[model samples]
Target: MSAKLYLYPGWLRLWHFSNAILCLILIVTGLSMQYTTQGDSMISFQLAVSLHNICGVIFVFNYVIYFIGNMVTTNGKFYWRNWGGFFKQAITQSRYYLYGNFKGESCPFQVNEEVKFNPLQKIAYVAIMYVMVPLVMLSGIAMLYPDIIIPELNGISGMFLTDLAHIISGFVISIFLLIHIYFCTFGTSATSNFKSIVSGYHD
Candidate 1:
């Protein structure tokens, strides 16, 4: 029998759903802006820009909630790296995903309050949360006020660099979303992970 654990907190669920919705809005509007022509766009260029900016602002607030909540709660420990045997643990986890799991081997890591993530998950989440998300946020802000931070280098404006960074970061985050969804299916049931987030219980 699988054990049920109270893994998610109410605040986290709120922040998570908020972030997910905002991300969907941003992604749709962003792609529309990128590939849509003026006459046949799904959303008008102006409307897309407005929605992206609005959702981005809301996402910032949700991100702040997540960051602060983690810092103030024991949940923060979930992302911490134990330096001892870190590499070995990471390699084992990678092997489980790549080879062992296909052979019916059990996972090397299991979720608990103190150790919620495997080594590989810890690293990926840390990079995505602390590095990529922040980079994307800052770049998006910079794009809004190009006049204040304009630095021309080799005939390229700083605005171009900021936009490039924002686009690349968004793309990386989108890819992460796909991988994350795939892993969610590894739970006891296909929707187990998702249900855990919604109901605060993991089986």
Candidate 2:
């Protein structure tokens, strides 16, 4: 029998929704600023900058809450990698996604109280949350206060480097968001996982 479980708590729901909104805002404004010239932009360049910075600050605050919540709550357990047989588990999970699922085979990983993410998810989340997000935030901060927070190499200006880093990281995160959304649809139904985040239950 299929078991329904309380997978997402209220605080996590709040964080997830808030973060998603802020991310959407940031991505929109950021891309607007990057691609459009000042006079030809959809939103004014100044407005885009303002929106991006504001959303970025809010996103950082939300990220802090997410970090602290994970540290203090059971949610963190999902992210902790099981080093023992990690590669094997990851391979199995990858195979399921790439081949097994197409052949009508069952998934190798299942969600439960102690293990929320599969091996591949754990690795991807770790890299995204711990590495890419931090770098993006740091580079953004450097962009905001280029003089005070110089992140330069030998002779290159920190502002230029930081801008490049921020752009690349944001692109990577954007791609990840697409992939994440696609995978979320792979649940029991197309919207099951989406509904779970809203209602805090998973079946």
Candidate 3:
């Protein structure tokens, strides 16, 4: 008989679901923005920009809550225990994914509250939360400020920089989403992992 596992706390569930929605919106609006270039005005670029920005702002604010909650462990979590365990788990987990798991082998590490997030997950989420998120937000704000914030950004050079950064940020986020979807099936029950992110519990 399998035992119930309490993987997610309430705040993590709240953040995960809300963040997922924001990401979905960003993806759709981003696509819409590109679509306008082909003369398809069904989803106007201006409107998408506004929606994306507002959602981005909400996400950023919530992310701050995510950080503080982690610090307090009010949610019973931390990104990882320490640098050493993090690296060790990450490498072992990567090897598991590459070789062990495909052979129907057992996972190298069993998860619990303290050892949550296999190495690969830790690395991916850390990168997405730390790097990709900030990069996108910065580029988004820069785009918003091309006219008033900086003379360099308002002109051709600024436009090029902001567009390149924004597109690159979007590309990274898209890759993360695809990887996340593919890896979601790795849990004991196929849908349990996804459900945990929504409901705050895993059984």
Candidate 4:
């Protein structure tokens, strides 16, 4: 099999990993902050809340920077462009992962600048970044200012809704994180994808 070298690009790797770690920090700290435990603590409730907030701010910074900077790259186009093909690609890739790839077949979609994602990736990346990511951020931000939001929420309980939204969004992201890591192991060397993200070069 011939190998192609398309350097993953440094900024993309930096943003991806940094964003991931910060987000995970938020996830863990957010959970710890939410539940009031009277026992041993990974982090004190007060400290968890404070750390979560700080991590959140860092996450937001990374989020905005990446969104603006990589709007033209896989970070964006992987979701926005050739949307019809996205659905088709998703179906085919799904089949490959479920059955065909086990038989050692080549990937259904080619990887190139013009056609980057294999359907599954477009939907996953898009949903995570565009849909779910914003939802979590919004609800988390709202939770940060329940008093302010409560007044505006009027009649409806903002705390209940915001907490629900935050929990649901966090669940989705947690699942995405799990799946992301699993798929990363399915690459050529069982670590090619991880290496790609780290070194910005998939070999």
CA RMSD of all predictions: 1.4, 1.4, 2.8, 2.1
Model 4, position 115: C-alpha lDDT score: 62
1 or 4: which has the higher TM-score? 1
State which candidate, 2 or 4, has the greater lDDT: 2
- The digit string of per-residue lDDT tens for model 1 on 78-136 reads 87746579889999999999999999898888886567788888888899999999998
Candidate 3 structure lDDT: 0.77
| Runs off by more than 4 Å, candidate 4 | 1-3, 72-75, 152-155
Give per-residue CA lDDT, model 3, range 1-203, as digits (tens): 76667778788788878888888998888878866774567678889888987887887787788778778874534465545766777778888899999899878877775667677877788788878888887787777676743446445576777778888988899889999998888888789788777776665
- TM, every model: 0.94, 0.95, 0.85, 0.90
Off by over 4 Å in 2: none
Clashes of 4: 1
Query: Which ten contiguous residues of candidate 2 have the minimum total lDDT?
Result: 144-153
The window of 10 residues in a row where model 4 has the poorest summed lDDT is 145-154
Candidate 1, pairs of clashing residues:
none
Sequence-dependent TM-score of model 1: 0.94
Better of 3 and 4 by lDDT: 4
Residues 115-189, candidate 2: write the lDDT tens digits.
788888788889899888998988887777777756567889777878889999998989888988898987877
What lDDT does each candidate get?
0.86, 0.87, 0.77, 0.79
Model 1 residue 131 CA deviation in Å: 0.3
lDDT string for model 4 (1-203, tens) is 65665656777778888988897888888788777688788789988999888887788788898888777665566557777755666788999999998899978776666665667877788888888988988887887777656643557777887888888988899999999889777667887878777776565
Name the lDDT value of residue 87 in candidate 1.
89
